[model samples]
Target: PPARGPLGGWRKVPRYNALCTLYHESAQQLKHLQLQLAAKEATVRELRGSLARQQQQQQVGVGEAGAEPARSLVESLLEQLGQARERLRDSERLSALRVEALSQEVQKLNQQLEEKNAEIEKMINQPPYEKEREILRLQKSLAEREKAQATSDVLCRSLTDETHQLQRKLASTAEMCQHLAKCLEEKQRKEKGNSDDQIATERSNQVFLQLLCFVHVLLAPEAFDSRDTSSRFRVHTGNQNHMHIQTKVEHLRGNSPGQPGARRTASQSEQTSPPADNGNSGSEGRAQGELRCPHCMRFFSDELSDEFLKHVTECCQ
Candidate 1:
């Protein structure tokens, strides 16, 4: 039995050993698979890290390739900014010049406006007058003054003509007086020695003196009074006529060298004395404005006496 028990146990042991061998092989394969999986995971991590590094290297190469164009674009943008700044500075300078020109023009206009204002003020400040009327008044006054001057000149010319006529009359009267004086001197020379001649010379001298006084009174009315001439002439005219007639008779008779001169002396003495009654009658006749010619007994007016005397003197001459 014991030997038989040993043979059964050895059979059980072979079965059990077979089971254990199968379990061991399964565990070993699982462990090997796990180890293989862990190893693959590790390999996968390394490969991903290596791929990331390769992608970073590829991106660095691309950035290096694009760098030149980006730098050129930045340089062009900087140049455009510089050009824009220069254009802005030029525009500011032009604006300043235009402002200065406009300021000067405004100042000139202001000065002209001030001058016009002053002229307007002057016109407003004065008093008013009529320009046409004032001019007419002044012209009228000038015309009146000119007319007065012309009239005065005409009056002066007329007065000058009258003065020339008066001077010519005075010259003629002076020539007549000279001729009468020469005639008297000749007569005195012719009758130098006889007493009767002496008496005649004295009477002629008296008549010459009276005629000179009468001529002077006629020429210069301012020298003597004229009122007494007519009355005095009337008183003496009769005697003068009688003496003249006697002188003419003596001249016609012709006195001889032996004859006495007594008749002539008596006649001269009688002529020298006048009666008072004759003077009274002459005064009455003058008062009545009756002038008579002693030779012809003709009645005449005092106004006609000057013309009558001129006729008598021409007849005697």
Candidate 2:
């Protein structure tokens, strides 16, 4: 076979096409990754808000439970006060009955005194019975009158003491009730404030999440155009498919005149192509395998050990 010119590399189209296909597929994968990253960021934002809300709800539950003791105490106190009120009412009723009974007793005593006096007068006016019998009856009636008077004094003192005690008890109960009512009002106010704060906090968190979601949705995915074009560049050379493309180019450049720039560009393009002429395998050749990770500058390790190969395969995958 004769030496071919530089432009005679179309025979290597299969290999060049393979490389172009690989680059396009890798680019599409990168685009997919960018989209996934955006989606993940949005999800992370929502998770953060959900975490905050869950914490707040947990705290609220704890606070409500904590408040129960004080509320229960208040309710118990109110119950006791109710019982006390019932007792006081009963006491007042009993006192009123005692006072009425005392009045009736006094009236009966007055009537008894009058009757005794009338009986004595009748005995004097008639003067028809034995004097000894009349004197005995008068003596017994006087003793009974003295006992009735003492009983009336005792009843009056007892009633007066009970009335004073009831007044003091009523005043103390009223004060206690007022204190409890005030405490309850204050507790309710504090709870209201806390609830308002929690609600505001939740609303703010919701707004934040909404903003994050909106940004994620509205922001453009990474532009494929911005990526490096080196991968897309298909450099045909003489070695690939043994097409002898460079030979053809050289023959053309030599036979044709006034095409030095095309010859030089073709030459440079061949020099820069991957898999430089070397005995080493294309992948093992550092000149061809020298890929700089766009994200990091670390050189890929040479080791084909299980771990290294696994990591590289996984990263590419």
Candidate number of the best lDDT: 1
List residue ranges in candidate 1 displaced over 4 A. 1-133, 190-317
Task: Return the lDDT, model 2, position 275.
Answer: 44
Instruction: Score candidate 2 by lDDT.
Output: 0.44
TM-score of each: 0.25, 0.21
As a TM-score, model 1 comes out at 0.25
Residue-level error in angstroms, candidate 2, position 6: 99
Model 2: per-residue lDDT, tens digit, 50-86? Answer: 5566668788884333322244654565565556556
Candidate 2 lDDT score at position 61: 83
Tens digits of per-residue lDDT for model 1 on 232-302? 33223345645643443343233432357635644554455444345455754453453443333344454
